[model samples]
Target: MHVVITGANRGIGRALAQGYAQAGEDVTGTARSGDDGPRLDVTDPESCAAFARGLGDRAVDLLVCNAGVYPDKGQNLDTGYPPEMWAEAFATNVTGVFLTVQALLPHLARATAPKIAIISSQMASDSRAPGGSYIYRASKAAALNLGRNLAVDLGPRGIAVGIYHPGWVRTDMGGDAADIGAAEAAKGLMSEFTALSLASTGAFRTWDGQDHPF
Candidate 1:
């Protein structure tokens, strides 16, 4: 399958790309800075359009909207998360996902059964709102909502959209003391991605395939 993964320069994105490639699947891993090439600034509409243009008519069987930002990671409700932080977080974590999917609709249509995996976070769940990291939480919640709606719209076209929390992975964002390594998270997520289908579309799931409470 031809899989397109965004923010693949590092962390879970890079691991997923490497794993998929080793398994003999066609993978296109992209980064924002175009580091070592294939630049895709998901925050910019024209950039997404340009990326799609570069792809031409190539089929994208699985589009992993993995690019995101936790701009207010260390900020607080009081004088920490500024308006710009909220804007940056939402732009990359929420709007960027929409733009990438919008730009890739044509390529996805070419596939027999296309799928979109949105990498959300467990913190997005309303049931587990302990507060703190408000910006990241809100943005992820928006992304979760976006994925659900996309699933509804795309299911008719044989496209499945699954929102996922990749676990507390050890990455630059996840921190060095996180639960698991990026490779481990990638493995579980790959398994989850493989099992996703029209029947399970619009589901909020964990990296290990457990249904996540919305």
Candidate 2:
């Protein structure tokens, strides 16, 4: 199988790319700087388009939308989440995913059972709201909603979409105090991605396979 993963230069994204490559699957890992792999600025429409053109009609069985930003991680409740922070967060965390999918639709259509995996966060859930990191939370929520709707629209074309929380992983973004290691989270997420299908599309699931509350 051929898989394309965004933000794969490090963290959970890197682990996921390694796991798939080790399994003998073809993997294309993209990053914005091009130091790790192909350069892809998910927030830029022109970048996404260029990346798709570079693929040259190659079929992508799995497209993982793992690129995101959590700029408001520890912002003050009163003065935090500035307008620019919100804009940047949504541009990378939400709009980026949509642009990536839109650019790859034709390549995905060439696959037998194409699937899109969105890496949203549990914090996106309304029931899980504890009130901090407003920008990140709202952006993730939008990504989750986008994935669900994409699932509905793409199901008829044999494309499935699954949104997931990749667990509190120990990474640059997730922090050292996080609950799980990147490898473990990547392994579990690969399992979840593998299990995705038209019947189970639009599910908000955890990396460990449990259904997450929307």
Candidate 3:
């Protein structure tokens, strides 16, 4: 399968890219900078369009919207997180995913049983614990809404949409002290991806294939 994964320069995205490429699947991985180079900037629509246009007539079988931002790196939401941070988070985690998917929808339509997967987080769930990273949590919640909306809109067109939380994966984003490694998360996600179907569209699931509460 020909697949496209964003934020492939490091962490879980890099692991996912390697997993697919090593499996002999034709894969296009993007990042801000890297070996194959960055082909996607989540904040830019023109870049996404250009990349989609460059893919020729073959539709991408799977488009994994794994790009995200977290303020936990240097900024904490506790001691006065700027509203601008919320906007930035939504820009990449929410709006960016929407634009990327919208731009690539046509190419996705050309594929047989195409799927669009958004890399979301358990923090998105209101039912789950929500005490930190307000911006990240809110943006992911919005992303999940977008995914559900897309399921409703794209289902008729034969595209399967899903939202996934990769667990506390060990990555730059997840931190080095995280329990699950990026490779493990990628491996688990790949298994779940293969098991997806129309029936599973709009569902929020964990990397191990368990359904997560919306």
Candidate 4:
């Protein structure tokens, strides 16, 4: 199987890439700096288009939209979450996911059972609102919504889209106090991706296979 993962230079993305590589599957891991493989700036339409065009006719069985930003992690409610920050977060977290999917649709169509796994967050849940990190939460929520709608639209084409909350992983973004390691999250996510189908498309789920509250 051929898989394409974004933001694969570090964290959960890197782990996922490694896991798939270890399994002997063809993997293309992209980063903005091109340090890992190709330079894919998900936030830029031109960049996404170029990346897709560079792939030629390669069929991508799995596309993981794992590129995101959490700029408002510890921002103060009163003075933080500046307008620019919100823009940056949404551009990367929400718009970026859409652009990647849009550019890769044709390649995905070439696959037998193409699947899209969007790495959202539990914080995207409206029911789990505890305030703080407004930008991150809102952006992730948008991503989740996008994944759900994409699942509906792409189901007829044999492309299943699953939105996932890849546990609180111990990465630079998740911090050292996070509950799980990147490898654990990657393993669970791979299983979740493998289990995705038209019947289960649009489902908001955790990395561990549990249904997440929307």
Per-residue alpha-carbon lDDT of candidate 3 for residues 6-37, written as tens digits (9 for 90 to 100): 88888888889999999999888987544555
TM-score attained by model 2 = 0.99
**TM-score for each prediction?**
0.98, 0.99, 0.94, 0.99
Alpha carbon deviation, residue 169, candidate 2 (Å): 0.4
C-alpha lDDT of all candidate models, in order: 0.95, 0.96, 0.87, 0.97
Clashes of each: 0, 0, 0, 0
After TM-score superposition, what is the CA distance of residue 209 in candidate 4 from its true location, in Å? 1.1
Model 1 gets an lDDT of 0.95
* Candidate 2 off by > 4 Å: none
Candidate 1, superposed: residue stretches over 4 Å from native? none
Question: Per the 3 Å backbone cut-off, how many clashing residue pairs does candidate 4 have?
Answer: 0
lDDT digits (tens) for residues 1-214 of candidate 1: 9999999999999999999999999999999999844999999999999999999899999999999888777675677989888899999999999999999999999999899999999999999899899999999999999999999999999999999999999999999999999999999999999999999999999998799999
What's the distance in Å from true for residue 58, model 4? Answer: 0.6
Compare candidates 1 and 2 on TM-score and give the better one: 2
What global local distance difference test value does model 3 have?
0.87
Worst lDDT run of 10 residues, candidate 4, spans 73-82
- Evaluation by lDDT, superior candidate among 2 and 3: 2
Q: Which of the two, 1 or 3, has more TM-score?
A: 1
User: Tens-digit lDDT track for model 2 on 13-128?
Assistant: 99999999999999999999999999999999999999999999899999999998899988998777789999999999999999999999999999999999999999999999
lDDT of 1 at 66: 96
